[model samples]
Target: MCDRMPLLGMFPSQKRSPPLTIMNLTKLHPFLLLGSFCLASLATCDTAKANDVVGPLVGAVESTSANFLYRVGESEQPLRLSVLLDGDVVQAVDSIGRQEDDFVAKFSISNLRPDTRYHYQITNTKTGETLIEADEQHAFRTANPARHGNRVSVGFVSCVDIEPNGIWKEMQGLDLDTVCLMGDTPYIDSTDLKKVRTRHREFLQMPDLAELAANTPVVGTWDDHDFGLNNGNGHNLMEGKVDTRRGFVNYRAHSQFGNGKEGVYHRVDLGMIEVFFLDPRYFSQTEPSPVDPTQPTCFGAEQWEWLLTGLRESKAPFKVLAFGAIWEDKKNFETDDMFTYWYERDALLDVVKNENIGGVVLLGGDIHVARHLIHPQRVGYDLHDFVISPGHKRTITELDVFHPSLEWSLVEGWQFLTLTADGTQAEPTLTAEFRQPDGVVNRQVKLPLASLTAVDSSKPDSGLRAHWSFDGDLKNQSVLGDRVDAVAVNDALVVTDGGVSGGALKLDRSREQFARVPRSFLDDNSNHHTVSLWFKPTSLPAHGTSERHFLLESTAEGTESAKSAWHLSLGMRSSEDASKVNLQLFTHTLQPATEIGAAPAAKAQGGFDALVDREALLGRWNHVVLAFDSSSLTLTLNDKQIAKHPLPVPGPASEFGGLIIGGHRVGAGRNFDGWIDEVSIWQGEMPAETK
Candidate 1:
């Protein structure tokens, strides 16, 4: 072999060419020759012709066996190749079939030892010539098997484009056993294969990157950019089988990963760690109209089954699931990006919680930034979502907003992690390192595994409360007319005509106006609590055109109180046509909506044909205070509880959004129009009428 080669220390004639190019090559590498022409016998092939048919190398990937893969032709073909494992000659058949096309070939080398180093070269079996004279020698390493007494370390990275100065070099010192490639590997423009190939070359040519892959095995899964379009999901493809096969062909041929099926998803064991890689794009469903949160799904039936079976049967100490995109929150719940298959996530969470499955950590990429999310028992099971994403080599994008349970969500430079294990105990250290292309670490943060799990649930859960100043001044407090204030009268705030005035506060004159308070303000630093607000309306509207007055309001709408969970409002009329006035207090869980308060059959008095008479409030101010404890919502009129309603079972906060005060424009619905005063807010129900 040494006498026949040039790139390696084989042949004397194939000496070093300082500025080597395809045109100057004396012979085509055996791998390129086999790729260019389907010649059964490599001995008679023309090395010159092979050199002329050169293209960009793309989808450069390594398999579980640590065999490196690359695409150099229209088809992902099986190329005749020779490899040096730990500096030893290991001639093998590095061929994987080209799926869905003739021009593309899927090449892969399997059955290799773990934690081993290997150097490889591609050449034509016939003529001893190199295809790209300069790219003759490249190296890679296989992943170490997850064995007993082994402390396997791994780093995860995702979302990268072709950039000159990348952080790949600094990420190398992370001391990893496996590198999780979480998609968006290359910017496959879908329209241009050249760009795709160029992107692949950008990563391969990086000396730092080459060293990393040569030292650590890479496991991968693809997202939109690497697959084709920007947000392309399932069903997106290039024209004809030729181009369509090119995308996945390059990915499959170049990466060491292999799936039982065609899509890029698989599993591997790293001592105590077993990772389940998921490809959510393939099984995505056509987004439904009106968007339903209860039914969002990413994994199709078959994939879900496969994932479940694998999880149920795995014997590893920890199940580390690598998701290519965000799972806890869908892209756009209200529009096209909404998920239609939520059953799978729910089922998975159920299994993890109920089955007592410990050490289950979900890792995701695709948001462009890194964040750690912990979903505690707000209403369901508590779990940890440990995510770390280095979208670009130089991270500069903000991915998420402020979250109360967030451990660390930052947009700095790239990140790398080292996870060591001792039996059932695994310690993961994540380093948010800001580094340069030359391997200089600027700023770094080393987070221990305890930071990932030791969260305190002692803080009071976040709720609404009510009180009265009773200043006896009615100015600038009214919901209508700017400067309509109302002051405290004895123990209750007095409301007359303008109610409370001044301070640029205005009320809805066209309808009955009331005041509003935010539920978040009422949250008593705890997950659950009670709230109450006091209101006084001078007069209820007799005409249906006048909007109903609101003591409290929320975004959720519908006749069902369950739909509008945790809302406390007092309104007259159901819609534009309803004549009866209904006073109500409601809470919503995942259950249904329920309402408390009597509905009038006819308008109230004062020219009212149905429901209660407006005459009841025509000439006097009525004191109404609503209070909520852990179990019930009590409405008090004149210091006496008139309506006591049971609270709904605790559940997801549905129909909750921005807070609205005074009268709300209920589009073809009922609007609130009445005066409100003596609004005292607290985190919990007003001190239970002090014994």
Candidate 2:
């Protein structure tokens, strides 16, 4: 057993021999053709002498069980597998024939000793000829059942087209417990079943990788490129979705494919470390909102719940959340990773934070760069995303953009990460090392499990609950670091200079622009609160028009005015006297079960609202405040108290949604065309000045 954790026994970079000359090195970063890997493997196997077999490829090896896969030509002798323990036969499983399905056979064996090394040989049961003709004997070891005894590690590889790809050889010697082919492992951008399956096999069966996979377990989920298209999503993204998924499943063996239903998201437990491999492409839906908030899904609903429930129930000391897409906010709702699926992303982090799931480290690929991104105060701890991409050299297109949370990045490509988990120590830690093919370490991070589980981001704090001084980034700045940062929907929000402070978020009415707030800040018990902000509206409709401009809203699209949980806007009063900018506060006091309800008469309405108007409140920077003290709600404009009304409800209201700023979520006509700066919120009461 490997007892040394990365942190406890830090090994400095080793001396390397002279660099192997790579072909076609260029100034714009070199490209390694896909032929390199296949050609290298073919040369080693000698095509004419490879027998009738493609593999004795091994997979899904656990503490007591193992699975094997292979594709062979016309051969009658059914293969038999022998598990050799020190030259003595310990256990064996005979291959089942299914020649019609492309000469494929599978072998499954159980009751193997844990943490013990054993050699394996596939032989013709009738002919008595050993099928494995490799130069070296093939072998594998089982996982340790002792959950916290030895250190466990997995190396991540993706976008695997680098030539002179010595990284495979580097990993060949590590004897890692598992290997995660993060995504784009085979680069199949077509839905053709044959191409998809063949590419996967070639990558997995590459000579340098073949021996390693036979010894160490290989697990994977797919990204866009390997998922059969670039930026593909939804249920019908692929022509034959079933076959595309089967191509992955048939070529590589995972403990379970998805939840035994749809998708490929699965959990792999390695000693004290458990990795949740997410299938971002399979179940993703296109949610174009101010949405039907509940309609948009990335993990779909099933996988979303499965992930949350699993995280909530997981007992592993180190839990790794693996995504085929990067965690950075790219704002390209149609194609980018987590940012487009902000709801699920935030929801997952919220669960990890609220439930105190410690030792949660995030992993990502599909962006051809090696990076360590630090998200400050994420779930009570500074969350870090370790990203590795381009198994060799450069990629077709490197996903580039400096996220606000970037700690460091090295784009020399040729990158992979060694994710090691050590739970034997008092403070178990998950260490991630982003390294290159040349044995150079770009960055390494070792975070303690205790640090991750300690903070309570949702455990209510006094005073300022939220503050957003755009200030070049969108992170929530408050005394309490709840990790509830704002999300810019549809690339609609951007921070610009010359605000009330350093910078302010700019939104245009011509585009779909708004910042989505987390649900926690607008919970049911948040009636007693103060909200203040500075804004300058650059665009507005004529006074007599029926168009209402929403500045802050929680209403779902295609819902009735009375159905919205809350809507704060600037609208007309009556055409005859609609001469000024009227600030309207609308909210529903709902039945406990529902957020939407039937219209109620003015006085019969349950929650408090007001129509406070000011003639000179447009085209210039102005300060506005909305203060509610449970009993009453007050509206103030430019340091002047405009209106104070008793708390009542117009209709049913449920805290079932999130807040959006600088526009109504549904359309551009109702969006606030403005610059909003220094938005702040206090949970307990109104600010002293307002009172």
Candidate 3:
């Protein structure tokens, strides 16, 4: 699945309009035509409520200062913030030049205490009129002092909907350091300034959102819908850019707003992690011609420069590059993901690799599905991309995406991702959980601090024992670089393109199958050697035809003297759901037999089963490894150790006559039906980890 494009026929978003050709917007500015309507809009706002006040919405809380955004009356005017900390009057914020601005001004309240809640309200400076009521719901707190070992948890959700949403209520009960509105806090894909500002007010005033903002600091950026229009780029919405930007800066509160001029690109530090919120849609191009030299860029020119500079200067252990689009190449007709801008993305990634920047994680939204992808050595390290999305809508189930980098993905339930950085450990770790209000976690993964650093990807650490790359012919690309005497046992295997590395061996279960490797690695003296291979399953999970979908097996087959060996396979579960596939590893500790075929007895030998989910297997090449040492044997799926079994004695492998790939030698329906590539073996130990 490395370079596969999403079929896209199965994908269609009703929220977005169809893409259009480039239009000349030089003489088509909407602001000129709508200039007269601003006054009428203000009169309409005044008649709706006589003396209305919008918010004391809180943002960008530090140990000493915090920013308060709100609106009073109808037009731009001078305003003051009345602050109270523990019933004592506090010094007002510094307003030397920004006392009188727009209706919504980001009041920077300074000289405050740390880790303390301060109650505040907005007032008119000229008339000394009280604009807001004295309510504790209008309170905000300063953050704890900045330190390396601070324990911080941040919750990120995107694509806020107009209809009722469960995540907004679910987030209020959780105590998070900060809540990020990744994009589309409200689905107002409008080009009207009046409507944009009005919708932003409604979004901030929602009961659940208002409550969460009162207690916890909020920071965010804009995506397509909120940026101007759905899939709107600079070429299409040249007129609305200024108005939409003004609305964004006036409404959303952030620690920094990218020089306070162009795009909502900023950085927010929560505990040990620093999140660089990127604006991928603000300056995006209209066309999909990624190879063109003179087309518009995704992040524009200025924003791209800022992004690279920020990454170079960051010192935090974990630097999260936040965007509104999913990082995978999955795209549709409506809009493009980061994959369309591969040149720019690769440039940014190459900077991280060449400069040796460590602990960088990519975070994105807007895919409508929760996913965890490990791009294999796109950088020097296997970069982890954790996607959070579709805060209101149910996840899109029709996207049958197959990307080599995708390790984990889910389309069930309504949830948001919570990332916590435990900075107090010897090796600080970043943990992400797919969470719901019911405390149900669909998936959870933890990354050690040292896992995201630089390493030599070309030179693997394990001592190579044998290797096979099936590109029309069996060739060993290991140190030996010799021809492997491998053959199709039944002439059913054929070379198939679209493999992870190159052409791969494809097999069909209905036909005579499996490739026989003469002089198998097990024939050597080493008993603890490891075997790993990349497999792409093509057949659907079977309910009754057979259970064991063998990928690699070296057993006695009731013919040879072998007694104890290993078999790596996919076992069908007992449940009615056929999609819930489980990865299985069967090993003969000390006993042996050929009677246990499909349903091996639970007593004869030990087996470990881990849910790999059939969705991950079909149409995608996944790295599967069996690491066995003297102490234990472990099974890995997509570089993650899923199952392990302990051995009472050493040398548990069965002494089979030879090795078989893609199927059990004697089975009719157990042969694998898909592609296989980069089959490898290591004698002593896997070099720290597999590629």
Candidate 1 total steric clashes? 104
- The parts of candidate 2 lying over 4 Å away from their true place are 1-53, 74-77, 133-137, 162-164, 259-262, 286-294, 331-336, 395-398, 457-691
Alpha-carbon deviation at 388 in model 1, angstroms: 4.3
Better of 1 and 3 by lDDT: 3
Please, what is the whole-model Cα lDDT of each candidate in the order they appear?
Answer: 0.44, 0.63, 0.64
Model 3 spans with C-alpha error above 4 angstroms: 1-52, 75-77, 82-86, 94-102, 110-117, 126-136, 144-147, 286-295, 456-691
Distance from true location, Cα of 332 in model 2, Å? 5.2
Estimate the TM-score of every prediction.
Answer: 0.54, 0.64, 0.60
Return the lDDT, model 2, position 296. Answer: 51
What tens digits encode model 2's per-residue C-alpha lDDT throughout 277-314? 99887777633222226435667667777788888887
Model 1 Cα lDDT, one tens digit per residue, 1-691: 2122223222222112222234433364555333334211111123323222222222232224534443344434445555566456664554532543333333356676665666666654344444222222245555455544445555667776544224444455555556667777655656465555445544443334544553345556776667666666554442321242254545343342334344566776764567787876654542321122333245655566667787878766556777667654332322112122333554565566445455566677666667775544321223456555564545635346433235566575454333344442355433334333345544444444344332232322211122333244423221111211232211222333344332212344343333332222222112233333334444455565544555545433221222333343445543344444556444432321121111101111111112343555444445655554534555665566666665435332222322334443231134344445455433344444421
Total backbone clashes of candidate 2, pairs 3 or more residues apart or in separate chains = 12
- Alpha-carbon deviation at 30 in model 1, angstroms: 28
TM-score of 3: 0.60
Q: Candidate 1's error at 569, in angstroms?
A: 9.6
Q: In model 2, which range of ten residues has the least summed lDDT?
A: 1-10
